[model samples]
Target: QVTFSHCVPTIVQMLLNAKAAQGTDFKGWKITIGGSALTRGLYDQAKARGMNLIAAYGMSETCPLISGAHINDELLKADEDTRSTFHLKAGVPVVLVDAAIQAADGSFLPADGSSQGELVLRAPWLTQGYYNEPEKSEELWADGWLHTGDVAVIDEMANIEIRDRIKDVIKTGGEWLSSLTLEGLISRHEAVRDVAVVGVPDERWGERPFALVVLGEGRELSAAELQAFLEPAVAEGHINKWAIPQQIAVVSEIPKTSVGKLDKKRIRSEIARWQKEGSAEQTSLS
Candidate 1:
């Protein structure tokens, strides 16, 4: 039997082929996906093969493995709806971890499925302090709990759905928009291979989201098509219509930092340079 703990689409395909060659005597599979975000298409393919796949969520601070979907339980089964929700959620906290969502004023809110707050945790295996940095450690645990820096909402079932990073959430005209949610929705388009949404300066809205997109090979998508796809989301009030990007830049690939995460800072710098050069060229033409 072969099981995968964390894998991308490419690796999952390889495992599926390998399992088929092993014959009917091979035992069932148990797979867990816990890194980055898994698309709905990948989840459906794995579930169809009777491969027991569960979505797990955690971070490095808690020695990872905070919570995971139960493989055989009906309540935790991965279905179309569950898979969609699971992809957005961080799952319920593990048995040993004490997790809560708190407001800016440090008051605990009810897990009524609509309130949003900062995720804070206290667990046995969590790190105690930052090595050789007492000041940083003190700041990290100011309220006697490890501040996760993630904004999330907990439903009645205690499932913790991560909305966005506190810093990454876009505040436009007094409304907050989730960049992660927007990115996931945009990436579902066939022409889009990968996408990222970042908050950029706007005089009217305070801040607005700008899309950084990577298209599939030989696929060309216009800014209008991207905007059209987002129209329904805006109409439903999931995002402000005005929050949509004024420009969508299609690139060969999004640059990532050494840690393999999207480098938004670098993207912002590039945008600034491009604007400056464009202004200089227009001045010379005039």
Candidate 2:
């Protein structure tokens, strides 16, 4: 009986599974996925199960509607795969909004599409600053652009592909690894129902990617199995070897925020505590 809804991928997954188990299907329900990056695995799954999954992106500061997926008439009759690719992106800039990526060197990258940088934006309707937080406000509007903290590549056609958050990018073995991209790739695994990837402190590499995965019902997923599955992609140059997660933890559930986004801040804190405890234990053993 539902026609339209907006929810994160996890909620959509749970809802679709529940309907399937009850011998029913969604009535071509339209779902707009946000709060976190939407993986193609989730998009395909929802489509296969009779749901239209649209990818959208925004933050609380921008009135929350900066971009969304919208296929033009020409692309409407195109193949499902082609259309799905567009639908899986963070989306183009909305009206009256100007989106640009700021390179690490502080240069404005071109829209030719190869560059990946921090997404900075400007819009008339965007909130100028946080309430009563002068220091944070100045930081937010530094250099005359609203820093989104999201790293993305914006194509010439204005197609915006969000790769990762600046703080969440994994720097291991002296190369950058995108946690969001890793999560998307790992989610393609049959046994993976949900996953969260984070950068953990490492003395050798500074920071290494650590993943927490939730397995599908009756699915037995092992670290080796998952790593082996990802090896082919690495060999294919689809991802760097260092991009493969250093550690993968299979957990019963991943924590979520009140608004249903991945609680990565909490995860980082927990990982730090566990690492400290492990170090103490090793010292005792020695």
lDDT of each: 0.69, 0.83
User: Against the hidden true structure, what lDDT does model 2 obtain?
Assistant: 0.83
Instruction: Give the CA lDDT, 0 to 100, for residue 100 in model 2.
Output: 95
Query: What's the lDDT for residue 225 in model 2?
Result: 92
- List runs of model 2 lying over 4 Å from the truth: 19-21, 279-286
Task: Give one digit per residue, the lDDT tens place, for model 2 in 114-150.
Answer: 6889999999988899889999898788687999989
Candidate 1 — which pairs collide? none
Give per-model TM-scores: 0.80, 0.91
- Tens-digit lDDT string for candidate 1 (1-286): 4554564343553454464643433236666665544444345445556565556667777788887653336545667675555644667778988888899899998898779888888888888888999998886786788888888788777777777788888888897787777876786676876677788777988887878787766788888998898799788876767766776778766766554456677776676666677631111111
